[model samples]
Target: MSRPLKERKLLVVAVVSHAIVHICELSFPALQIMVAAEILHNPAAYQKLGFAYFVATLVFGAMALPAGFLVDRIGQRRVLILFLFGAAASMILVGTAQSYLMLVLSLGLMGGFIGLYHPAGASLLSLATRKQGAAMGIHGVGGNFGLAISPLLASGLAAWLGWRLAFAGLGLLPLFCGLWVLVDRSIKVELKAAPEDTDNLDRPDPKLFLLPLLVLFLMATLNGMCYRGFSAFLPAFFKLKIPAGTIPLVSGLVQAGSFTTLVLIAGMVSQFLGGKLADRFVKEKVFTAIFLLCAPFLFLLSRLEGIALLLSATAFAFLYFANQPVSNALLPNYVPRLMRGRLYGWFFFANFGAGSVMSWIAGTVAEKFSLAIIFEILAAIAALTGILGFLLVRVSRPDKKPEV
Candidate 1:
C-alpha cells in the first residue's frame, strides 16, 4: 500500500526542522574554541570551550522535565517557536559577546532554549507518524546530520567570514524557521495524550517502571560515557593514527563521512523496521537486541592503526549513533504520554550528567588507566546495556500484547 503524501510531508518537515536547528546549533562548537582563544586569550581555550558546552548541555538536561511540561501545556507549536527564536537570539549574543563570561552566558541560554527541542519535537514527530520507532530513527538522523555537519560548516564559514560573522549571520536561520512554523498548516497537534498511570514502558503499574528506568538509566549513562569519550578524543585519535600533515581535514572527515551517510540511514531503518519486526516476531527485545549487536563493532574499530583506524572509526561512529534512534523508538511505545517527557528527561540527565563527568574521567583514565582502557570500559558497558535494553523491552510489553 502506498503511504499518504501527508506522512511523507510530515516526516520531511521533521527532518528539515531537525537538520536546520541542529546545524545552526552545532555550527558554533567549532568556532567556540577559536572565539574563546581570541577573547579569553588562553591556550586552554579549547578545553574551556568544551566545558562551556558541557555545562550548557547539563543545564539543558536538567530542565527537560519542565520543558516537557511547557510543551504539553502551551502546545508544541508555541514552545517550539520560543525555542527557535530564543536559540537565534542566543547565537547572536554569542557572536556579539566581548568577554568570556558573556560567551558562557550566551551559550548557557542557547542550551536552555535547545533543551525544548527534543521532547516537543519527539512528541510532534510521534503524533505525525503512525509508527513511533521509525519516526524516532528519522528524528535521530536529523540530529546526527546536525552534529556531523555543524563542525564542518561552522569551520568553513567561520574561516571565510570570521567567527563573529558566522554566528551573527547563521543566527538568522532559526528566526526565519520560527516565523514559518508559527503559521505552518502542516503541524496539526490534533491530539493531546490523556494522562495515564504507567511504569517506565508507560504501561500500567507505576512502581514497576522503576526497574526498567534504572536499567535504561544505566544504559543511558554508558551511552553517555561512550559519547563523551569518543567525541572528545576522536580528533586526537585521528591525529595520532593519520599523518600529522593530513590531521586537520582527516580528523573531521573521518567522523563526518561515516555518520553523515550511514548512521542516519541506519537509524530510520532500525527504528521503523525494528518496531515492526518486534511486533510481527513478537520479540519483545527486538530493538534492544540490535544495539547489543553493535558493541563488538565499536570495540573492534578502536583497536586498529593507520588506514585501519580510519575505516574502523567510520564503522564505530555509525554503530554508536545507530543506538540513538532505537533508544527513543522504545520510549513512546512503553512510556505513556504523561511520563514521556519526565522519563525522557531522566534519559538525557543520565546521559549528559554522566557525560559531564566523562571528560574529566577520560582525562584521568588516560593519565592513569590509559585511553585504551576507556574503550574496553565502553565495550563492557554496551554489552551490559544491550542486555538491559532487551529486558526493558520485555518489561515494557503491554498487558494484552503477546510477549516473546
Candidate 2:
C-alpha cells in the first residue's frame, strides 16, 4: 500500500477498535434500568446496578497496565485481536448470565478483555501515522461516537430481540472487527515496533517528571469519577426526572436512553473542537477551563428537568468530552517517548480504576438522597479536578526538559 493508503487503513481499524471498546464500556449503563427491572426487582434497583458497573469498570481500568506490557511483548495487532475475541466471548457470557453475580462477573470479564484496546490501538496510531494529532483526534471521535450510539443500539436491540439478544448483538460487532483485523494484511506490517526500540538517549530523568505526573494523575482520578458517575447515572436521572412524552422510547427500554443518546451526540461534535483547541492552546490551561466549565453545567443538570435538563446535559457532554484531547496531551508533555506507553497505562488506571468506585458511591448517594444529588457531588468533583489542573500548571515545565 502507498503510505497515505496505509495510514488511512490503519486509522480505519484503530477508529473501529476504539469505538468497540467504548461501546463495551458504556453498554452496562445504557441497559442498567432494563437489567434492574428483570434482575433486582427492587425499588433501589438503580443503586443495586452500580456494583456490577463498578466491577466491570474496575477491571477495565485496572488491566490497562498489564495489557500495555503484553502489547509491547507480542505487538499491538496481536493484543487487539485478543481483545476482540475475548470481549466477544465475555459479552456472549453476559447475554447468557443466569443471576446478578453471573451478570457482574461476565461484565467484568468483558471489561478485562476490552481494556487491552487502548494501549494496543493508541500506540499503533502514534507509530504508523505521521500526523499523530489528527489520527488521535479521529480515534477520540470514534470513541465519542460509540458512547453516543451505545444507549440507542443496546436499548433498541433489547426492545426488539430482548436484552439477551441486545448483548449478543453487540458481541457480533467485536467478533466481526476481530475477524477483519485478523485477516487484514496491512495491520501486521503497520503496527510497527514498540516505543522502547526508538528511545532517545537524552530522555529526562523519571524523578523530575514525578510531581507533574502525580498532579495529572490526581486530576485524572477526579475527572474519571466525574465522567463515569455522571455518564452512568444521567440516563437513570433522565428516566426519573424527565416528564413523560418528552422523548420517545426505544420500545420498553425507556425515553431516557433516547435522551442519553442525543446528549452524548453533542460530545461527538465537541471532539473536533477539542482537538483544535488542544493544538492551539496550553494544554493544562485548556484542561483547567474544561473541567471548571463542566461544574456549572453539572449543577444546572442537578436542578433542571425535562427540556431544560436535556439542554443542561448537552452542555455538560460538550464540555466533558472536549477534555479527552487536552488530557491525553498532558502526559506526553511530561513523559519521555519510551516511558509514555507504560505511564499512559497507569494514567488510564487512575482515570478508570480509581474512578470506577464512583459508580458505587454515586449509587449509594442516589439511593440515600436523590439522583440530583449525584450531579451536585460531581459538580464539586469537577471543581476539584480544575483545581488540580492549576496545580499541574505550577509544577509542569512543558517547554524545558529537566537537566540530568
Which candidate tops TM-score?
2
Q: Which residue segments of model 2 deviate by more than 4 Å?
A: 188-208, 248-252, 399-404
**What would the per-residue lDDT of candidate 1 be over residues 188-243, giving only the tens digit for each residue?**
45453322222235346664556666777777777776676565545444544555
Q: Against the correct fold, how does model 1 do in TM-score? A: 0.79
**What's the residue-level lDDT of 341 in candidate 1?**
56
lDDT of 2 by residue, 86-187 (tens): 999998899888889998899999989988887777667656765454566777889888998888888778878888888988999999999999998568
**Which candidate has the top score in lDDT?**
2
Error of 1 at 43 (Å): 4.8
Question: What's model 2's overall lDDT?
Answer: 0.80
